[model samples]
Target: MSKTIFFVIAICWNISLIQAQFGFEFSDSIPVEIGNDQLKFPWSGGINHAQFSTIDYDFDGLNDLFIFDRSGNQIMLFKTIEENGDYTYKYIHNAASLFPEDLRYRVQLIDYNGDDKVDLFTYGIGGIKVYKNTGNLIDGLQWEVVKEVLKSEMPNGSFSNLFVSSVDIPALYDVDGDGDLDILTFNIGGQRIEYHKNTSVENYASTDSLIFKLENECWGKFIESDVSNSIDLNSNFGPCANNGLNIPEVTPRHSGSTVLAINLNNDNYLDLILGDVSHRNITALFNDTLHANPNAVMDSLDINFPSNTTPVDIPIFPANFYLDVNHDSIKDLIVTTNASGSSENKESVWYYKNNGTNEVPNFVFSEKGFLQNQMIENGKGALPVLVDLNNDGLKDLLIGTYFQYLDPADKISKIQCYLNTGTSSEPKFKFITDDWLSLSNSGYALRMHPTFGDLNNNAKQEMILGRADGLLSLYKKTGPGIQDYSLEEITLKDYMGEVIDVGQYASPQLFDITNNGRLDLVIGKKTAGLVYYENIGTKNQYSFKWVTDDLGAIDMGNIYQTDNYSTPHFVRHEDSLHLFVGNQIGNIHYFSNLDQDIIDDNPFVAASKNFANINTGGFSSPFVSQLTDDGRYHLFVGTDLGGLWAFVADKDSEPALKLTKQDTAEKQILVFPNPSKNGIINIKTPALKKLQLKVLNSLGQVIITKELNQPLNKIDLSTYRNGVYTLLFISDSGDFTSKKVIIK
Candidate 1:
């Protein structure tokens, strides 16, 4: 903690000015909770990649939903509860605590032992493991491991190939035409129906213990059908299956598949319904009642998804189920889909009602978020870019979610806006939308970084976005309002009109570094180096010339890329220019270019490698905001798991900390001025030798703990941020009282 490091940053759009003072020590605070956890963001945590299963778990005769969130690795139960003469699934987020603890994604619930009780089955490289249902409240709604379902040893995957059990869908069925239930599995990698027929007993009826042997490794005949007769190789990777009956039509599909066997046509045969991750769609194949059910005919299902939305390209898998949702004679189609939106992989349950006869089904779209109670997921990760889109004095939130560095077609760039409802000093937010600027799947940007500046000096700020491809694209503002943004994707060219690509992960920040009236571009890339592009042209008409790819010799390297890393935020403190850069390893590095020509290839002097001890786990992008109504600044950092943390600095002055350079605005909580004079506050308590004093921040994290043996004492909060904090007093008698203190 050096006096020279005592400078704070004030953000004005993409530009910043600061002098980190010593009076206030910045600490973490949580003003909002994502999901229903309290902050109540639009959705729960994660992408919500879920799988659906139907069963009468509550014994209500009505089917309930057994949802397996593959990403969350928890099995949630949606029970049918009768209420006010009507019945609906109990939407409580109570997940069944299975004994082996965390189950891997999918689980099959059925009468495995023919006990009429729903048993659980899970698969892995070790083969299918069975969990017998002891009773209705078996293990108090917890499924415990019972026995192994197979007798033969499954070959452990070699250096070249993966084992059968380690892959995708696994099912227990009678595909061998035998009285016993056999195993059928189909995966994306293999693209084949692997059959393991039950051989331990003549029947799988009421048998506590069971085992099976591998029968046909590829159960059906592989047919290289015409281009039009495909299952998963369509442009959208959908199962169009124009080919005739029963062959393994899914051989060409690249994404994984889900299969469920049931009597759909009531033809005394078990028909199969299929679902896939890429171009997630459900197709039906009515069995011809042959051995191994090889010759099944495909009549593509008329499934009407919510808003015509079908979840595609989930990180792991997507699934479907057949149940009589409305108690109709014909069964309906229920799918766990992450609908097409500005955001990606925001999964929810949807059902298509059966409108036709039992033999010939017609499914109509019903709901997108069917029977979902708590929707709190924002996405896989969150990256905050503070902007006031509404032209308010307050700083609004613009966060980019979906950090997986996959193909653009497979990635969804979810942009959310948490509109500031309260003033800039004491900000409260409401999630306005997840489709800000509608830049979702537009260019399929990975780890997208957005910076706003009036590059053309048109009063409105144009959005310059840097993506994983090391490219920069601008989304120019067209209308007066913040929501009036239409993306026009065009590659940014250098002075010679040559396209500029940084190799990968380009995080371009806009600011004037060469004392020019126009805004210049500084980019941080996957190599953890800074690239500078000087705007040589005027404000009205802009032309960017390549200045230097390596600015200040700043290089963080690729080793810190375990998380999304290296985003640079420029700050001007006192008479010197400073750069505060965040890295993949969750630390902010500071450097000074004092009185030096930054474009003259002079290397920046390192101020401190790890400044402020500010870490946000990983993928930490530090943002300084002029958020306080009184003028104090707050530091915000984005996390890998869709988290936005706030840090505030305690000040010594009564007035808000004066901004050395702030061109725009934003807002945290705490107060002590109401109960204090200057930085000292009087504490009144009963005289006790063993009385204890405790202080906590807004996040309920303890900050200070000490023994208070006096009735009245003075506590100095000048070194703390202005916000609501908790003060707890505990006596030796175990009596405790807590008070909310506002540090001013």
Candidate 2:
């Protein structure tokens, strides 16, 4: 696809890249060039969070881009093309495989020393790492991974960490007047803009590493504690809001996701602009102080001292990539991430025109999606179940929506039907209706799971819904059409004839365990294990007896079940039966039945947790439909965001490495500076706590023993000779961890 999608989104925005060079007139200042010769800073997307990397990969000196595609977790690279001093970019398809397959992270090109050779810095949640370019930019990067930790000094002279969690996507600047880059960050639905000062430049460090200290917790007065309180009653946002906090509760109207420092008024001093992340607006906080007049002393009191408008809303959207797609010399919005848009908005590039100025950004929200994609965005909490509802030999789709992000008139639970117009092996869905029973909510959540079973020996299948109220409802097919179902209230009784509640998000499936020609039912509850219901009546009349609430010993770990509940489905192909479960932590696990009879207490062995990289981003509802009787099926997984993902198999064979485990034993903790130069090694264990440690040198001698109660620990191996040693961590009531340490 062409990277410059001009036909879909031609929004011309003048958010002033004039702050291209956010220079400071401080006594000891360092200038950082934000935009290149065209004053273009390629950025923008996400719901509200986006991270990108900028580099001159081809030695063209005109920087290329690496952006977050959001939908797919692949490395996206856009190389810049310079012609007639005007720049364009070409999408490099092969550049994706060079980087790791991980979530979106801020990647930057930095040169620690005076040498122009490139070094890379990646800002992520786990921690930041530095990579030196291997000078091989053509075929493969294979940049040797180096474990480098950026140290941080807390406010009270204590040590902790510089987590990207501290600031989602921080802005790099020389805020401390120390002639080095500092970090400035402002978050969405948050209170303050933080300034992390780089202290390495002041110390004249011999090493190339950069150390940081918290200079100002609240760098800008724009977001003070009393800004939303009664104290600032005359303020733009204060007059409109009274939550008594720094941030306003108003959504896209007053919400923001990103913030950066740039000069907007042609006033030498770099000002702050809250980028559009959640909403389409660029809230400008102009700096009152002119350059070197007061030097490079970054004072929070100067941000919007005279009070700029709360929001001059424009589409400086976060997680969005910004290129002059039209070569208009003006930056426009790029909406690749499905972060912001109306419920009717398709997966296309959405844009708006800024009719108003920088103070009251009057954006014309007049455009639909720019590109026409085949994705059906059915709100949030996508609990998809596959069934041949139309009786066309092809499996149709039934989805339950929670209505998150996409607001509708109603917040009630409803089932959506999608007809598969294509063949059984590869299905193409056409959305028929949402209420196949109602219409949409923009940002609300509910728990609902749908399954199919024939209740009364009827040739046509009926819909069994496990609702949020922990009760079951039957929808009987009254006609032959797909929407020919009528609601029927159900009263489920236990084996003892007593009514039983199965808890929330009940996932029910029908199967014959004893092969007695009767359909027995299995239900997934809020907690672990499956619920079994046995049929006792004849084939014409149905009456179920709840035999066991815990069918098997399958415990899904807690991932905040207060709202998110686990789901289950069954797939039987001949003698072997597979149980696929969707849990609260965005993973789908499968278990194979040891024997056919589940009610007889046969334990199910776990199959694989990392199959097909099937992560549903929490609140997963798993379903699989047999394409053929000879062990071929199609996988359909749903997520909390109300999106359905389909995995299919045409041939009898499955993809290799689909059933692999990613979380190995070595991933439990981190041992950095392993090939120790000075015998100083750091142990960073974010997963374990209260660990008892042991270090054995070569020849199996216990050289050191210690106990650690914290996540970060430092050890000095300088006294020992340079060789390989074993470090083991043991906990009486937890998992045992071990790693190899090399001192060379």
Candidate 3:
């Protein structure tokens, strides 16, 4: 009866028990911490709208972290350093800087010219800046500005929108099957995208004089007269004159516009995808090479034509990335929202299921499959990352967000994980509710993007999250998959600690049974029937003592053998205690404490009486409540068949009972050794009296009928063929239990 002894035994036994494979788990404590102290930066407003890129900048073969520090207006790198046995983050260098006053700079690293060396691209109010990697520096990698655009490249530089409007995150891709990568930047003010084609093809080493010209009429309204033989740049620089793709006025555009080029239809050609932070939907422009003519004049370029007149609308407006999350070979989209919406539409992550067909595939939305919004608070500026945190071959989602610094409300900022349960073809996921990794005081806010890599080449991926306070933290996957949790039983004395004994118990119920304004405990045991504990503790702590007098273990053996009694429910009627007893046989027996105190050794002698036989197969538990506004008590019974039955029981006498044969057949009757290899099967029932059990085959014929005298009855099925059979248990009281069994 000792809680400690029970806990120890339970833990020992459960060590070999296989847990039900569902739900996700995370670390209870942060294993690694990288804060302002290590970054040497006084926490300013944490990195907002932060972008990250992972690369082996130093040729170390290990992926290192890179981030654009918006607050400090500099690029920060967290180089991975290994000592003795621990991997730590070393503050390498602030690689480059944007216009220190302009904090909207977005950075991306890509091998722009396919030279194998990663190059840095940063865009802001100052215009697009490309930094060619000149190899790694001892403190950090060195960068040389290769191309700088401060004004519109259109003819005569007619429009100033390109230089004034905020440029979206540029997408790099080989748009025309050219070896060199091209740049596509969407101008929020111009309402168009500038496609900068890399003209220097063969020369890989030097980028000193790389010419990037504007491909006129690429995304704007076409002017047929300007297409004379070869394209002319004389009249191309007017209002909306660039070859950049124009943003449809119907489509919502904001400063947070993002562009991504991917082979959406599996067409082997890159398609354009656009998203805005405040938009309600995403737009996709399917690539159509049939309409494109690279050799045509500037105004005749086919890149502006879409297979479909209108863009393909996706549900997740602010999509972050299109990843093959299920490993299904096809890409799926991930989107997140902030708290500015309604309660039902609060900040949360969502995924669309890709129904395969490379050329314009359709995405299906799930009903119950999405992670609940409560898992992560309003993720306004936070981007969800898809990674295999546990290396379980399935991708898990990581969402990190926080409130503004020095906010009056003491809201805890943290990163939460939702592990994928389904496979690459069919994805099933659930959020880890209990084990959240708290980042208390780490920062007021986090950047939108987080990068993941095996920084130490340890086969496990580590996560680097940017904080608004200019500090970054790296979280290593400390354990395999999620944490495995199981309940353990301990000795009763150890569990009680200082509290006095109540009684031997099975199930307990906590409520103010005596209406003393303080909560009390009621427990029901197999042999003890029922016992009460008075609340004698203070506000800070709880202590209980056994009520040795009033309701001390009222024996329920007379009504039903005191074997499997459920948690007791107490209801007061006319200043009298109405006790309802539910046994394993689906019966609710009533007993009343009329005098409010036990006067005789056997309280059941005068109070015990039959109440309602709301036969709902075998009862698991029962409770009394006035479900309606009328002052009438209703007995609600929970059955072993996974159903709840309610019946009016205002009167003292038993209610009339009637149950259909089909209703009784639906209840679950215990059957064991089902796939009887030994040719023997056991059928158990809760009935104490003689019962008639019938076995039926697939056909409507009765195979066997035997009267069972004991609760445990066995039958021989050795001669029966391998198939499924039906079991029916009929008690002398006309109540029945039915189950299905298979014999192999």
Candidate 4:
């Protein structure tokens, strides 16, 4: 079948067409390219953008994009285009534009009104912003100011700070049972959260009414709930103070901690797992009480962070949380943080059990280092996923280490997988294997986010990892244990024109891109945002191919979730996959069977000096999410410099952000010395372009623009700064266009 027809059939019939024929020949050519209309924003100094937020705002069957501004005060929304690869930021609404300029890391965009259009609920400067989807983006998407529930008015013009307001993260649920959606915002300040439910009569839009303000202690559900009328869940959420969980001595610090509720013990009801960021305690709330007004007692367990005071050093930053690490009926936890000895340069993993005594929540430690048997200089990026790596019924863990550019002694990024013996009576997590899984095995350099799925339909799952060097590595299970495996590294040289960040931040998603018999591997690379490779099981090989009309923004985390068995559906949940990646990146790209052909076209790309001349070698991968959303199955993405993002699967489209033309300008911009030294004078036409360009400081502005009526000119500055300046060129064009220029 033709590629076009196959994709259409795959979307219509979904996974059935691919799985129909067991041994059909896969495609030979791999289609790959950058994303569509990407718009890059401007910045003076550096920006540490993390993940982007996503949701199917309009319920138009497409997921919209919402990104947090680096300093975290604003949220930039973009409308996503599934078909034809359209990723244009139609709006940039700040959820915290009214608050102080503090970073608002966690944010969520959901349809609280069930009116088809998704609303914006995020932790901004001390409050939340409820941007209503007016069902129209013509007038730039109006936002009805939701009152900051965390703030109380004082006698004077000032405000009385009730709870130390910090955005822990936000989730959506039908908590009030009014059929209208509710917002769950966790505040890290005082371990308090304000559940603002939409109390509107009309389902289209409604104002937020402070429904449940469960406070006094930091505890919450991993997934949002719909338990209206009572605080039953709160009562069993471990300990709750009448005031709040405020300590005495320790300075108030926002320890990057998290709280989630899942069915850890396999109980139909969700249990709570709270990470004590400030202390070394991680409490679990077992849902033992089935009574409607559950009198179940909340128990505390300690996930000992790596520290000198304890037998096992307490975990530095209790990050990298996952579900079911052991694969037993009970839930598990994964903590990623700095190594015990070295704080600035190190990485480690600690797993915990769901059931344990009050003092111990069943903790285990597995030291992660270069499998080559090299003494650990240090590792950074900490991520873990539970999978049956060796085809064992029990689940194992795969970890990716971030290389923190340690001196000449530092090794390259290492991807390692561990095999679970499934032995709980003295469970052992042995280092199964290691490889530069992100790099191309064909000798080319590539990096990929690692994922697991049955790519060859052998009833056993395989590992799919993309590379920065523009290659895709497929690992097949050779036997029943972690030690048994063969690797087939598919070099996508033919598909990618330039060596871009393929699978830079996004994980490899396994799906049936082609209507062939077996499951193909789909990835959003650096240069070419989205591409597909057909798996030819007969030859145990893969043929590269491109998804039709799929050119999106810089692709980050990509994930696939299936529901139907006979005719499985696929969803593409993410920011744009092609074009230039925007400053505000999505967490994960969710694509359902219905959106196989819908590709993000125009991706935003703003040049920033922050990224200029800087070796973003390992600093780039997309923050990925392995958790489910609203129990509907979802993936999340956190940007390096942006904010958190998510992708939910179903009939709904991926959430797209809307951005307006803040400003645009382009003139004869120039720089001299050809990779120059000293400084460079940038002269442009049309009155020097009213803007400033500094060399990572406020002391300098656009000193010169060599645009003397010529489209092409040179900027010469023999005596000036000697740093990198993400040149801010402004003109009749939009003022947000960013470019990077360096001085030697």
Candidate 5:
């Protein structure tokens, strides 16, 4: 080697030695061991969605995760838990081979069979599939095709198309004086909804339908076959089906809407809140009378938007939660519309004040007052985050809008915060979007969601925003007045221009997937795959490692850069972190058992995706959590083509749902005090991760490895680098990787 080259190598080695000495020392720093094996999917083609439930179905108190794959045509179930404080997901059931070509959209877990066991009702293309929870866990639970049962109960020609969207079965109690558990199905394209009054006896088995035996008390068990002479709820459109303009309502008749069960009248009997998708109305139905008739009068809450409102268009909404914006026990509706009106500059939200029990209640669905005229890029409003920002009792709204080629005054994408001031009388709202600017390249806004709980146990709440540039923007609530600090900007890239934000749905969460006390950010890049960032060193500097490939022991690194992808949603289960991502072709993916590893000079771990082994078209994003079935974390996925999917985490894996964004957030992580002739770079991890170590520059061309397994790793800095040098670490177990310590 040349004398100059040898001099450079010696200098680099010394710098690596110095940096290593400065990192934190651990007592018994052990390597993180995570399960990278993929779970078995039940479906055949592809999955479009998934949801998780935290409720203990088996009374074991252990929460479960459920997945739904529409294209692949199966549902999967899984158990979530922490083994030695480290999260691991175990498969419980697989039921894919059963239903083939039956594109399942939505799912509901209820005691349909009335055995006290949670029965699952999956509704979609081929109708409904009822799965009875047979106490036999080893037998994989018994299920039957309930479509035939539904077909028998409905009136002839009532549903010529037989295709439906949403379904909400009635509670156990009979609505009318008749003793029967009446159930209703919301037939989206079927024009009208049919009622199925259960007539099962002994709470477990029923031989008769409510139509035949009107006075049956055990109506919850038997399967109703048809809706003959059944009362049509929305009968104004006649018995015809299909989306047509000649229909009574020029707007689609409840096409792609959602149904929610709530005590609309405090009658203890859960009423229905139907968010009308086509008409842009929220219809509230009261189940006070169980009289079977086409002209049965039920209350409807229809709030009119100023015609052509972007938020109320056809197929623009999925399902939304009912939050009491005014803090009244009587829950209010919080609906998510694609756009405020016409996918343009005017994007508004309606705050419908619940008026107890009235179809056309006097309550107004007014627009959410915020940064209006803020361009709604491509007709998609800011991914709203509803929470108490200032720790105020009332819930607030955070709307993040992306890319405004028109707005020059405020170039960076803005995250407008709205404080809910709805009280007893006056429901005044306040808007706060002053300091919420893109802390990075000042790119267009994409999507933003809140991350609850202070990772460091700080009293104030923190927020994580996903940008159009694949960056995870972290903000810390600091000081007495709850001032927001632009803490760290995490990007999934080693090179500057390599990170491309899909802007679909990149979900994020704080999890201890590695069992460490600190919370790490698990990012789901719709098409890109999953990336986990570890917070190491003092000051919590964020360093990411891609573990998708490492965990699966497969090479999918290049797949992350693809354009056809779905949205990725995440939720933490015990010590394990669950992620569901859909593809453009409607495929749902589920990942579990996330541990850390330093393999082949890169950090990697394993995860499972799209069970049922089916392939659904991509372009869907899945929302999963343990909050679905009264604490039983159920997985909920929504497809662009298909409707919605709900899967019970069968102590096993489920089916596929076809799907699924990228957003650009400000930059947070900085390696400053630059121009250090000695390559000493100070690294920080504000987020969290599993394993975070480092490699040193023994030489510019010839590198040296210095592994620090602790939260904070150090490297010797007394070496070369008057210009720029690399400080790389194996970030995660995914195919994509990065190197950050770019010293000046």
Candidate 6:
């Protein structure tokens, strides 16, 4: 056979082997519901238009829900009456008085005053209205509206143009690390985002207000102090601010738009994302925060427009979502445009594949594999879950669609499963709409955001659907053949036999949290904080029994704030498992494992510790994976404001392997600066002649090879991407030694 034909045959044989090893046999009957009514919520108004916010306002151990009735111009507070049971929804009578009758305002319940009670912050036409939670009343919680703190005191209060318009987007975070939550707002009349320092001396005192002064002159100045170096917005303009650091300048074009702050470069400092409506593009101001300086001003690199080419050039609006579409471990941008009017099928959903490094990503739009005709019009959202759904070894595309502006009663939404029919190198998919595979029937009412994993450890992937009506369901593959497909609904229940109401915009995540060999479930609710379900089911059978009574539902203290949408991503650092959950507010909370005992019901409560809160504003989801060959993992956060942010774990900086004394002595090879930033390193060796040097990535894939001609040789890594790389030296004596290097 020819080389091409032999390659095709080998690929086919590999696919067959993968399918046989990973294929799963789905059980008959609907999947059992594991939890109880703690997650289920009654349909209030039309489920299609309801916007929910999850927070434990009362600090009552149970998570409370806030549902926004847009058409009714009302806010309904659903307090958790029973720990693992029902929630009573009460109309906030005082909320109607404090907020405008119109539904244009955004409400966030946060403990801004450190009073321990969650206070209400509403942004509307005039300014931000603060409602102090006095205490629990006979009817419900009593909230008293205070003076407009943001309008009268902040730096932007002097801007006369902003009085008529409201702050477009407001976020409450401790940006300066002073323990007090400061106010960060993107004004309606300008591109600049104003920062208000929380100088309140007394807790819960309305008189302890924010003041704006020239001491923190501009938002950029404060960002400079928080990052490693000064941001040169106007590099051409002589000596802009904070000593004359030459950096890329950001010229904001569209005023009164949206600005999302996230840590795009993984430096742990907040980066700015500005939406350019006029140019129909988004600008990414990368945060160049150095690890050495925790509070220095961040220098920035501007990714102004998407590559100015094919896939990236597609007109992306302010409202865009992201996922690691190709599963290259890098988060890719998923942009959806309005349906084309012409007959020829134009690509509506464009996958901007991330081609660059983890820190600096270059998104290249995919031109193949995906079918344009299979595109859904006005997609509410699409999650690119790269899993072997058809037991084909090749990752297939599972696209979930929530038809915007469509009534849930219409029953038209669906979860489209496309089977990969092509090879790994060049993926080709055929949209599966057959009865056994298509979720159109259940998906209409579901309006789900699907997450795929091996819940049963059968090797095959199981689809976990988070529904709009606050329900968690699982769909597993039935048989081994490509045509043998079936859908089963896994029910979730508590020990009391009550169904769990995982609140709306439910984010269900399955991982081995306790390292017990069994996968645990961590469900995120838009209106009910987070619910942890420990998987106690046996591997012999397909059934899973999740226990929640031990840990109860450990609250992450309203990480999502006012925004109900958030997802949790887990990573293992050393022996401890870390959970990084991202909220719609763009902040990521890092929880580290303190204990590993899985038998204790509430082990996670004592074991899991909240370490850091990294700000990456308004993200759709946070992804944790090995972005580079260096054994360490990087957290890639996907934002709603058209940007991808990355953060390297602290543990990832160290070498994955320890060097042996004998190997070091005999070879006597020295590589300077194991963790290199400039992408250049010197390799010094005794009698380096007749030695072969090879550089390999994390996957053991050799990237560069060179023969040593001198005792001292310099290796330039400017062409290589950032991550962990291994350096191998093979001597003429038939001996080999290797060392690891990190390119930051």
lDDT of each: 0.55, 0.52, 0.43, 0.36, 0.38, 0.46
Please give, for residues 606-705, the per-residue lDDT of candidate 1 as tens digits.
6555554444334557666667666555666664434455655445322332223322211111123343434466665443345577877544447778
**Candidate 3 TM-score, true structure as reference:** 0.34
TM-scores vs. true structure, each candidate: 0.50, 0.60, 0.34, 0.32, 0.35, 0.37
Q: lDDT score of model 4?
A: 0.36
Give each prediction's root-mean-square deviation over alpha carbons. 14.1, 16.4, 28.1, 22.6, 22.4, 23.9
Lowest-scoring 10 consecutive residues by lDDT in candidate 5? 657-666
| Candidate No. with top lDDT | 1
lDDT of 3 by residue, 342-407 (tens): 111222334565676545656554321132211232222222345676666766655443222222
Candidate with more favorable, higher lDDT: 2 or 5: 2
TM-score: which candidate is best?
Answer: 2
lDDT of 5 by residue, 428-525 (tens): 23544433543324442544434444555655666666655556555666653333555654544422234524345555655555555665655554
Q: After superposition, how far is residue 675 of candidate 3 from its true place, in Å?
A: 83
Full ranking by lDDT? 1, 2, 6, 3, 5, 4
* Candidate 3 local Cα displacement, residue 385, angstroms: 27
> What's model 1's overall lDDT?
0.55
Arrange candidates by TM-score, highest first: which order? 2, 1, 6, 5, 3, 4
Across 1-744, the per-residue lDDT of candidate 6 in tens digits comes to: 011110111111121122111111111111111122121211111111122344554446655555442222335445556524544443221233222233433456667666666676665446666666655422134455554545434233442212223324354556666566566554333333455556553343452354322123235433321121223452223223533232224443333333444455555576665443322345566544542222234455554445445523333233123334443456555443211111011233455677875566566766621222222211333333345666756665554443332221232445555565666444444555422255556543634666767766677766677777777776765677543445565555644555666657666777777676776777776653566676676543333444542233344445426544557766665665555566655445544453443444443332212122233223345655543344544444443322223344343123321111123333466787656667887888776356789987544457789988788888988665555577767666444555667666
How big is the positional error of residue 696 in model 3, measured in Å on the Cα after superposition? 81
Clashes (backbone N, CA, C under 3 Å), per candidate, total: 32, 28, 24, 149, 186, 45
Off by over 4 Å in 6: 1-386, 392-437, 440-447, 453-458, 480-485, 493-498, 542-546, 549-564, 573-575, 597-616, 626-638, 641-744
Error of 3 at 318 (Å): 1.8
